[model samples]
Target: MGLTAGVLAIDAGNSKTDVAVVAPDGTVLATARGEGFRPPAVGLDTAMAALAATVARALAAAGAPAVAHVSACLANADLPVEEQQLTEALETRGTTVEVRNDTFAVLRAGVTEPRGVAVVCGAGINCVGMHPDGRTARFPALGRISGDWGGGWALAEEALWYAARAQDGRGAPTALARALPAHFGLPDMPALIEALHLRRVPSSRRHELTPVLFATAADGDPVARAIVDRQADEVVTMATVALTRLGLLDERTPVLLGGSVLAAGHPRLVDRVRALLADRAPRAVPRIVTAAPVLGAALLGLDRLAAPPESHHRLRAHFGT
Candidate 1:
């Protein structure tokens, strides 16, 4: 296919979708964002259509007819069956289609090398690793039931739990007792608790409290600091297990961190992650991905086209850090 034919790249997360069109030489042709995919809730057809809307917009923006390939990194595509299902669905929209978990997007975005591990801490947490020999390691990442911990929602919930307990004298005193309710403009913990239980404040808004927890930790709130510490521990624990599983513990492995929680560069989190990784996996180098993961999807498209390193450079430069 010619460069003008281009490749369609899609990064579909639980909360949003980003689509891009890139030529064979890594020139970004078009980019668009749209609603998230909800395959489990709305079925595969609806989910694919949601993603296709963005793809169409990108194609229109670039004035391209049909892409030569499609590289998609999607959220909720945990199982092989799910990936295959999505791959089949996406192939209908393009000539050639590839689909993988969104964490792979983060992994590829941060590590230029083929071998590395990536942990994403957004609304939820997930870890995945790749070996140069084509081996891979990944967690199920189905949230609490899957033995996962330390994401924005988890952090906010931890803060609320501690604050509620502290209010009833079941836990140690902390600023969260006041800060958590105050964040919602409530008078006291009781009001905050009541509103949360009644859905007056809505549990979905719980994620909004994550920044409050981080800010309180920054001010030396012991309980909030403890949550941050646990988050750091979880990040390192996931990375350690992934690196060990892939047998990259002794190798100079790149440990890539992504998503809003880790990407925020909070000292309380990053500093502790650095310290823990130094002790546990001394050879692992931690790096926070500054680029959007859609770039990773685009790069995968270029890779499928067998574009060279210079093409990768041009894509990165066009996408920016």
Candidate 2:
């Protein structure tokens, strides 16, 4: 029999790392998950070790003899320099590895068409695009600095800031004062502040507040509604930037919406963003992404193993199911 071909795919996010082994025919052979890989939080050694452990588990489960190709989609791998470092890191493991920003994998996961935009609002926000003419554009996505907002972390931070200001009589009072404490099992704002100061509540867990913010917004809390509205606007702005840069604003672009924030189905947030995009690019329509990013990473690995046109059908077929 001919040698069995296998690909290793990885999605390293702010809170967790997911790995999968895929057959050449696009079947997911096995999968594994581990802790987060954000360099600022986990350090390079721990991050790489986590990724390796997850991949090894996946390969073992799949009974794959060798990893013919690898693709890693990472949250902080935005800049080319960072991608280079990630590639070197993966190469050290003796695999033919391709590293790219997580947003790129998200876009690939959501779109089979030649040109489209993807926005992800998980721990942080990011947007990317690929045009039919082989052009691509991605936002800096460096959080507040890049004016990229709207994500679990951003919502949580905004909720806490608004709640604290309200407690100090500096901002409008909202349901968040009660909602945040109820959500976290804290008796009062002072207790919540103390817990945060003591690191009793880890940063990743702050994403828990995102739902509370959404709830308050739905309940007619003006401050919460304003925060959600602003976040929606920011997401739209990021998508617009990517579309304009890729010159795809005029096309029937598939705008993929991923991440927990958008997945919550907040009508205000989703409808407002849709309206904003419609105003600028009437062809833009939101596509709900159902495929996991790990699959996207695998598709990227498959892309490296075969020409784009050759793999397009297989990629779409695998994800479409």
Candidate 3:
């Protein structure tokens, strides 16, 4: 087994996993991608096997048996206990390990420092905040039961609800009834509903409707627009709450936006988020985090190591941030 003073950095989201081996000098020696991390869906051992396989590939490519640290930003590690459990699960003989919510990866990937609030809207929505002093604020992010409301899947489901209701005379009229069905090459909402219910159209295909909803809204459909607006509201609401908890709302703090939905930068939603943030958290500096989140995992490891400023700069450069 080879030895190296480096970090095995991982960003494991609900959809996919990314691993990187970074040397102490901040050069990324290797990287690997694999299946998503979902311990709650698959058992813990199964999930670990998938992630460990990816990590092993990266380590082998980097010519290291292991590094001094394993920094994992994982999806579904919502609570501190979950993070601690994952840290212990990932621990190796010669390495220290830490695990944090995936949103924190988006946060650190955008910020120059360890302090910021980040709102991520992908398959689901989540928020997280951190201070340089190690204080953190986060949410349960356990879907509706956890009081969460925005995400691609949720948006698609909402659009379906509104469209179904509009078709059945149970709700106000909206173009979603037409646009949504048309997107799937169906004649109308009833046909779309039948197909979805019977699995003629895979349920996973529902995510495609999110963009259709946005397009309908852009065409001046009030119902669709309201849904989009509500999503923007949720994003800002979460960000504002996080910032306030971290005492950053009163200061000029960075609020990072990440994930597929936010990264798309839909003009209406983006504009609304900016306007709301301006009003509710006037000093909050909002920006989109487009960098690969594995950089943030690596940065967190370097932060633990007390690596120099130049190392951080070099790492950012490697990730093109």
Candidate 4:
């Protein structure tokens, strides 16, 4: 686990994979991108094969015979047991490897030190926090089963529910009734609902309604606005809990907002999130993170290597952070 041969960093997501070879001096010698790494879908052997191809390409480009350590930030490594399983799988390559949930990548990418909370909300939602002492906080993030809510997919579903109810006289009126179907070129909520129910609209395209929901909220629709506000509240609630768990609530700490939903910076959601955090965790400095997660993986590898500040600086500069 020494840094004799330098570090290999991997950022593996559901749709894409990025890998890098970094010298001891923090010089990025080579990098590679490949297909998605989804062990659950393709099985461990298939996923590892895809990852190995990308790693081999990176190592070849770097002219490296081997790496001493592998730092992997992987999607689906939700629990500690999952990280351990991945670590054992990667160790077969004859390198010491450490696996962490991909949320850690977003968290580390946003902070100079591994001492911040990061909440990511793309198709799904997740949160992770790390204390400077190496303690970490995370959740199962298993959708509703894990008591999570307010991701893009969930928001879309919620919007449809309200719109349907309003159209059927079972709930309060909202512009979402018009906006949701309009997004799909439908005449009304009933038609939209029928299309979706019959698969004429395809379940895969449901995420397209999220922005329509946001737009409806921006137009002062009470139901849509409530949903948007609830999302913001959920984000802050998770951040507050993480900060409290790490004993960072009273201290000034970074709160990183990432993934598509937060990164979009919708005024209603983003502004409400800021306002709530200011009230609940006044010391937290909240901001959006745009750095590539792979950079965080590389920086983590360098951390394990105990590389100098110059190394960290060079790595960040190279990644244009």
Candidate 5:
């Protein structure tokens, strides 16, 4: 084991990328944040360039001559081919790199031990689990296809669809029609539609209306409540699939929830998901994870080094808790 060894960890999410450099002892030497690496938001060339820039900045701040290893946990990296592409891109910067889906990193960061299920609902939704004996399964996150639903994008789309329906009197009346336009300072639904058509309103920014959906549901809007309830059910379904695949559905299995939607602390959504999970998987209990994803990426980097026992202990003590 090299006492002076350093690791570079990168967590590339849908909305942002976070990079960190850490010593063998787990003390973070430096950190940097950059734009999203997912396609459409950032092309392969731009994403690699941004990764290099962030890594260079962190290394300079850490005063490290070079990093010995890199572990990147990225969104949209579920397939082996995607992982290979991302790993190749990072290796061009001159370090041995390992790549895995972002949810694995979240699971590592949130789970005290190594075996359990993790459900992430950020801009997109995914569920993943790893067993103690190396078995693994990941639920497909087909993004609006395969009847998949959940995540910020799902919520936003639901809200907009409801608002448009309510405007046309084809759906149950809801406050979303009023509230959504107010979000953009538009006086009515027609103007909101016009703004969307004119490209005055960006698709990503439409996610901001998700909160209004929850609020409308709270205030007894039938359409909004239906959307929220359906989303909660979808999340529970994803979590259940992961638990089942891991054989953790029997009893005493722990499931951790992470991502923007779950972390938002929406009581109704939380309660609905808890109810659904309990009904479907009687033995599973969902836990809250407050650990940052960067820590998970760092743990993966350390694991790759096959660091000494004492080094692992020190790293976890410094960053895991």
Candidate 6:
């Protein structure tokens, strides 16, 4: 076995898993991608086995027998109990392991400093904030159960709901009445509903309609536009709350937006978010983070390792926007 000690970084979201081995000098040695993380549904043994497979592949590719640290940012780690369970589950793979909510990866990726707020709207939406003094603000982010409003899945479902209503005259007529059913190659809302109810259309694929919603909005559909606008409002609401909790609302705090939906840079969505922040938290600067979140996990590990600023800069340069 080769003797290269470095940080093992893992960013495990609901849809994908990214793992990387990075040297202390900021060199990324090896990287691997695998199926999304499975936990809370799948038992601990199954989850760890899947994760271990990816880690073994990365270490093998890097020719390293062991890493000094393991930093994993994972989805569904909402409650403190969940975090503790994940930490215990992941520690079996490395000498030192740390697990945090995946939104923390977004926060670390966008802000150069350790302090900032991040709202990640991917398959789901979550918000997190950190202060330099080590205090943090976060949400449960368990969908409607946790009072969360926006995410790709939720947005897509909302689009479908409105479109179905419009077709039946229960809601205002909109382009969605035609466009949404057509997206799935169906003739109309009734047909689409039948397909969904019969399980012919996979419910998991509903998130595909998120981009469709945006495209329809771009085409000047007021209903679709309203949905996009609501998403922006939700993003601001989460960010504003985080900043306020951390006492950074009036300060020059950096608000980072990450995840596929936000990072896609939808003009209507991004512009509205910017506009809302102007009134809600005027001093907050917004940034869309394009860097892969695994980099953030790696950076956090480097911080724990006490690597200097130069190392951080090097890693950033290697993964530059």
Best by lDDT: 3
Q: Compared with the true structure, what per-residue lDDT tens digits does model 2 show for residues 1-321?
A: 223445778888877888877776666777899887888667878788878888778777887757788788998898889889889988844358788888877778876654688888877889888886678888778877876777888889999999988887998898888889778788877788888889897765788999989999999999999999999888888888888888778877889888878866789999998999999778897876767787678777777676455455665565563
Give the whole-model CA lDDT for all candidates, comma-separated.
0.89, 0.81, 0.92, 0.89, 0.80, 0.90
Question: After superposing candidate 1, which stretches have Cα over 4 Å from the reference?
Answer: 1-4
Clashing residue pairs in candidate 5 (N, C-alpha, C atoms within 3 angstroms): none
Query: Of models 2 and 4, which has the larger TM-score?
Result: 4
- Per-candidate TM-scores read 0.95, 0.90, 0.98, 0.94, 0.91, 0.96
Residue by residue across 1-321, what tens digits does model 5's lDDT show? 223346888888877888888776667888888877765456878777876787778777777757888888888786788889888888854368888898888887876556788888777788888787778778657676655788888898889888988899998788899999999999988899888888898765888988888888889888888888988888788878888877888957767788988888688888988899889988887876667788888887877776665655665676657
Per-candidate total of colliding backbone pairs: 0, 0, 0, 0, 0, 0
Taking the tens digit of each residue's C-alpha lDDT, what string does model 6 give over 1-321?
596666999998887889989899888898999878868768767877888899899989998878889899998889899888888877765689888998998889887767999999988899999998889999999989889998899999999999999999899988987888899999999998998899899887788889999999999999999999999999999999999999999999999999999999999999999999999999999999988999899998898898988888988888883
lDDT of 4 at 306: 85
How well is each residue in 184-300 modelled by candidate 4, as lDDT tens digits? 899999999999999999998999999999988898888999999999999999999999999999999999998889999899999999999999999999999988888889888
How does residue 42 of candidate 1 score in lDDT? 91
* Candidate 4 displacement at residue 56 in angstroms: 2.8
Screening candidate 1 with a backbone cut-off below 3 angstroms (N, C-alpha, C), the clashing residue pairs are none
- By lDDT: ranked, best first: 3, 6, 4, 1, 2, 5
The stretch of ten residues in a row with the least summed lDDT in candidate 5 is 1-10
Query: Candidate 2: which pairs clash?
Result: none
Report how far off residue 296 is in candidate 1 (Å).
Answer: 0.8
In model 5, which regions exceed 4 Å deviation?
1-4, 92-95, 307-320
Model 5: per-residue Cα lDDT at residue 217: 86
